[model samples]
Target: MSAALPHAPARALNNLVTQGWNQLARVYNSPVLQRVAYQPPQDEIIEQLRIAGIRRIADVGCGTGILASRIQQELAPDLIYGCDASVGMLRQAQARSDQVRWINRQAENLGLDDGAVDAVVSTHAFHFFDHAPALTEFHRILSPGGLLAIVLNNPRSRFARLLQPTMVQGLAYFPPPDEMRTLVEAAGFRITEQRPVRRPIPDQLVPDILTVARRG
Candidate 1:
C-alpha cells in the first residue's frame, strides 16, 4: 500500500530526487558539473575530525565516493561507509575504493547498525534529502556523543540561490542556516558549530553553510 495523502508529497519528492540523481549519476562528478556544483570544504572537514579525534565515519549521500576516498586517504578511519541512492554512483565509488564500504542506500533509510558510526558527514547533499526522516536516521545510527556535520549550499549565494531551480529537476531547497540548526536540534542533536565557508566574500563565491552537531 502507498502512503496517505499527507505523506504523498514527501514520497513524490523522494521519487523525483531519486530519478533526477540516477539520471545524473554518470556525469555527477564530471568537470562540467564540478564547476557548477558547490563542493564542501574537504580540508576543513579533515581538520575538524583531527581536532575531535573521530573515527568510523559515515559519508551520507556520498556521490561517487569522492570525499570518502579523501577521508580514507587522509584520516584512514577504521570504518568509512559511503552510502548513496544511485546505483551508477555506487558502482563508480566501488571502482575507486576497495576499503570504503559503498552501499546503495537512501539518506532516510541507511542500512547501518545502531551506534555504528562515530561521525556522520553529509556534504553538499542535505538539501536533496527528506529532512525529518534523514535526520532521524542520522540520530539513530550515530553513537552517543557522535558528531554530525552537514554541508549545504548557502541560499544567499548568487549562483545557488538563483539558478538551482533551473539546474535541478526535483524538489530542491536550501534552508537558512538558523532553520537548519533548529532542524538538527529537533532531531536530537546539540549544535556545536555553524558557519559559512568561502567567506571573506569572494567575487565568484560558491558560498556554503557547514553545521556541526553532536548526538546527546
Candidate 2:
C-alpha cells in the first residue's frame, strides 16, 4: 500500500480556504453575516487591545478591514497594518480606511521586518492558517513581550462537534484550546489568557475562543 501523504490534506485545505475567501470577499461584510459571524469576537478583540495599550499593531487575516478600521477609530494606535492573503479581501479593506496600511500577504509570510509591531491580532482567522509557520511569523514580527491575540471557533456543543468534520471540509482545521496553547508555546509565546468569548447569540453552538500570548 502507498504511504499516506500527510501534508496533502493540509495543502488541499489551504487551497480551498484561499479560493473560498476570495469568492466570499464581496459579500463577507453583509450586515446579516457581520452580525452573526464577525461582530461579537471583534468586540472582544478590541477590548483586549484596550487592556494591552498597544501602540503599533498588525491585524493578520484582516478581511474587509472591519476590525482594523475599528481599532484605528477607537484605539488610535500609532501604526496599524492590515495583512491578508486574498487580494479580493485586501481590496475591500483598502476602501475602509487609508490610515490602515493594507498589505497582501499570507500569515506565514507577512513580509514585515522583525519586531515591527507591538501587538498582533487575528480574529476568526487562525483556523485557516498553517499553524506552526504562521505562529513563527507572528513571533518574528512582534517586539519582545509583544501580545498576540487569536480568536477562533472552538466548538463545545454536541451539535457543533457533529458538524465540525463537515465544516473542516470547507473551513480547514480548528484546533481545540489546549492544542492551540501548545502550538503557541512551541512557537515561543508565553500563554497569558485563554477564554471563551461570551456568545452574543446564546444559541450559537460554535462559540469563539480567545487565546492571548506574549512573545518571550
What is the TM-score of each predicted model, taking all chains together? 0.85, 0.88
Angstrom error at residue 132, model 2? 0.5
Q: How badly does each model clash, as a count of residue pairs?
A: 0, 0
For residues 8-38, write the lDDT of model 1, one tens digit per residue: 1225666667566767778777874554453
TM-score leader: 2
Task: State the C-alpha lDDT per candidate.
Answer: 0.78, 0.84
Structural RMSD, model 2 = 7.1
Question: What's the lDDT for residue 184 in model 1?
Answer: 96
Q: How would you encode candidate 2's per-residue C-alpha lDDT over 163-184 as one tens digit per residue?
A: 5774657666678899999999
